[model samples]
Structures are given as C-alpha cells and as structure tokens.
Target: MLISLSRVIKGYLLSALLGVVIGSLIGMSRTINELLLPMITVIRQIPMIAWIPLIILWCGIGEESKVVIIVLAAFFPILVNAESGIAQTPESFLEVARLYKLGWWKTFSKVYLPHAIPQILVGLKLGLGVSWMAVVASELIAATSGIGYRMSNARSLMRPDIVIVCMLVIGIVGILMDKAIGIIFELFTPWVEKKRRD
Candidate 1:
C-alpha cells in the first residue's frame, strides 16, 4: 500500500493544494463560508469507519473503493493544514516577492512553496499515516488480499503470532514511510534547515 501510494505523491500534493486554495477562498469570503462550510463540516464529521459500508456499496468491493476510502481519510488533514499554511504565510515574504515583480507561478514555487514545505510535509506525513491505517481497516472489513486481510484472517484462525507479526510489519512500514517523506522534504527545501538555525 505504501509503495503504491508513494507513486501518487504528485496527485496527493495537487489535490491538497486545490483543497487549500478552495477552502481558503471560502474561508476568506464569509458569504461562501455560510454556503459551503456546513457541507464540509458534515463530511469531516463522518468517521472513516462509518464510510466503509457506503463506499463499498457505491464503489463495490474492489480496489477502486479501497482507494476512494483512503483518499477520503487522508484528504482533510492535508487540506486543512495546507490552507492554514498558505493563508498564514508571512506578509513580509509576499511583499518581497511582489517588490521583485515575481510572476504568480514563480512567487508560489520559489517563495510560498519553499516557505510552506515544512507545514505541507507535516500534513503529508500525517495523511499518509492515516491512509495506511484506513487501508488496513478497510481491507479487514472487505478485502481478500492485503496485510490487513492477512491479519484479520490470522486473528480469526487463532494464530496470535501471525497477528503480532502483521502488527509489527504495519508499524515498521508506517514509520519508514513517514521518515522517507521527511527526508524528501529536507532534500527539496534546504532553506528549512537554514531557517531553523536562526
């Protein structure tokens, strides 16, 4: 699951960015907030577990359904964090970027993105961890294959050792995924390291 998901980092980042932009637009305009916030609030309140049955029904017990649930579980944290990071970007940086006549794209990539990388990475790490967990919970409920299914089967068959092994595997994989994201963030945003020193 982690390996497959790693391939979707660009997709995850794009989706998260879109979420932030849209959410902030709504947040900034109180009119939109009154219209849209309740819908988002309702969706946010729906537990990932509670969505399993409906997701399975709507999407079927296939890879598609599982992936959808994972996205739902992972999306909100990254969305909220990205929005906050973007909206809270220091006004000084925006002023500097504007003074230099940086185009919107360059300003975003060179200034905003670099500045927001740490917070965005934090959200990604959290989202990935939760997605990993959601995948397992999902597989246990309906999947015939996957580590979660394996663990569930082991538990049902009274194989405690196998269950323990599965738990250890899940923990190790989750930790490694988070560490990998951290390394990537550090590599791409060396400025973050310099900022910490001051």
Candidate 2:
C-alpha cells in the first residue's frame, strides 16, 4: 500500500506551509491572540475526531474538509513554536542588531530567524505528526479514500490483516515523513547543528 512519494511530499509540505502561515499570524498579533485564544484552547481540548461530524456537515466529506482538519491540527504547533522562538531571541542580539544599524528586515532575517530555527523546526515537526494523524482521523470519519478509510473498509470486511497493514503503512509513512523533515532542517540550519555540537 505504498503511496506515491510525490503525493506524500505535497501533502506534508502543504500542511506545514499552511500551518506556519497561520501560526505566524497568531503568534505575532496581540489582537488575534486575544480573539483566538479561547477558540484555540477549546479546539485543542477536543479530540480531532470530535470535529469530524461538524466538518462533514460543512464541507461534505470533501478534500476541503480534510485539509481544514489537517490545518486545524497543524496550525497551533507551528505558531506556538515560532512565536516562542522569536520571543526567545536574546535581547542582547536585538541590541547588537540595533548597534549595527540594521533595518527591521535585516534584523529579522539575520538575528531572528537563525536563532529561531530550532524552535521553529520543533513546531513544524510536532505539527506534521499531528496533521498526519488528523488526516487519518478525517479519512476514517468522512473520506472515501485514504489510508484511514482503507483501514475502516478492512474492518468492515473483517480482514484484520488488512487493517494491520494499513496501520503499518500510516505509521511507516509518518515516521519517514518526520525523518525527511528533520534531515531537511539539519541541512538548511547549520547554526542549529553547531549549537547542538557546542
């Protein structure tokens, strides 16, 4: 039950990218934080499956619903990580940037993002795992196609082996996806590697 690598990569990238965008907005804006804090808290408290009924009602078991579900699962982690990472950037670094007469853009690109790389990746990793699981949850509840739906069909057919195989497929794919992201992060963020080594 191997899925195409291209499709898997596309799904992972799309979910992570969308999650980062929303997370960044949420992390940066006091107004949004105030508005969404309660909503996010509530959503976080509920299991991903709890939303399936409502999602189905609104999106009709389509791709939109599944994407929304994954987004919901993914967005919070990336946002929280990025915000915390940015916040954690040393005040000393800010001062150094200012002393250098660096513009806001330069300061962010140089002093902020590099320092935040580890934390940002942490969030991305967490969000990706959650999104993968959320995809299965969404498929199990609503979608006609997906590994989760496949498992469900197997159960209906009383084929325990098929269910086990599908579960293995999801697990292996999820692990490989996370590993790929980790490798990419390491490749792109040598500063993080140096810090860890030190």
Candidate 3:
C-alpha cells in the first residue's frame, strides 16, 4: 500500500502541475490551442492499457513504469477540465481586467485562475480516482511490492480471504482520498462551498 500510494502521489502531483500549466496555455492562446488540441485528442483516444507493454519495454517494469502509467491515466481528464474551465472565463471579466489596465499576469491571477479553480479541482478528483486504479492495475501486471502484489501473492497461495480484504481496503481508501480532496478544495474555495450550500 505504501509503495503504491507513493507512486500515485508522485504521478498525481506531476500530472496536476503539467495539466494546469499546459491547459492554461491552450485555453489562453489560440495558437497553442490550434497546434496541440488535435494531437492531444488523438493520444487521448488510445487507451492506456494498449500502451502498457510499450511502456514496460521502455521503462523496465520498475517504479518508473508504474509512475508513467499513472501519469498517463490521470493527465487527460485534468487537462481537459482545466482547459475548459479557463477558456470558459467570461469575456466581460476580461473587459473588467482591461478597464483596470491589468497586465496579462494580473488578469490571469485575478480573473482566469479564480474562475478555473472549481473545474480544476473536479479534474484533480477524477485524476486521483483513476490514478489509484492505474497504480493497482500496473502493480498487478508487474510489481514486487504494493497492495496489488500482496493480493496476487495471496491468490497463488489460494488465500481468497486476503484478496477480498485487499479489494475492500482499496475501495475504502479510494473513497477516503476522494472525500479528503473535496474537503480541502472546499476550504480553499469557500465561494464554491457557499454556492453549493445556496
């Protein structure tokens, strides 16, 4: 569990950072959107499972391979949602920024980023869920440690009870992580919470 959690956390953080930065660029710059959107769409269409063998070949079925797979599994939803959220920022808001003579960085901080936070959080939640699944799946296929490996080992020993226990633990842990993220985001974006309450 610790091994898997570490990989998931590393992959999740990297993916989130890349997703937000790249998504913001794609959303804000028409040239970037035109250049990258088609390629991203094509890559996104190819399922992650199909890439596993190639990834293992490239990364040698080690921690690197597992982390790479988790990153792939989590990156797209985050990128899409962040792009959508930033691009959906109101034109009127931009006008306000311009009226105040705000520069690009200031406008982004004051208008675009704030508008996109909620959607970005939604993407992060989705990414984290998929990341958990990805780590487990990759570990099952190729790993010496982790909850998945423990389950696989138990299967060979005919310990069905351990497998069942692992499954239950996975589900519980995933739910807890999801709820924790939601709570943290609600704290960071209090307006979002107020809107939900209303």
Best TM-score goes to which candidate? 3
Candidate numbers sorted by TM-score from highest down: 3, 2, 1
Clashes of 3: 0
The C-alpha TM-scores of every prediction are 0.83, 0.85, 0.95
Which segments of model 3 are wrong by more than 4 Å? none
For residue 145, model 1's alpha carbon misses the true position, in angstroms, by: 0.6
Backbone clash total for model 2 is 1
Model 3, 1-198: lDDT tens digits are 778889999999999898888899899899999999999999999998887888999999789999999999999999999999999999999999999999989988889998999999989999999898888888888889998899889999999999999989888888998899988888888987888689
Tens digits of per-residue lDDT for model 2, 55-101:
88988887777777776677677777877787677889989998999
In candidate 3, where is summed lDDT lowest over 10 consecutive residues? Answer: 187-196
Query: In model 2, which regions exceed 4 Å deviation?
Result: 1-12, 25-39
Cα distance off (Å), candidate 2, residue 117: 0.8
- CA-RMSD of model 3: 1.2
TM-score of 1: 0.83
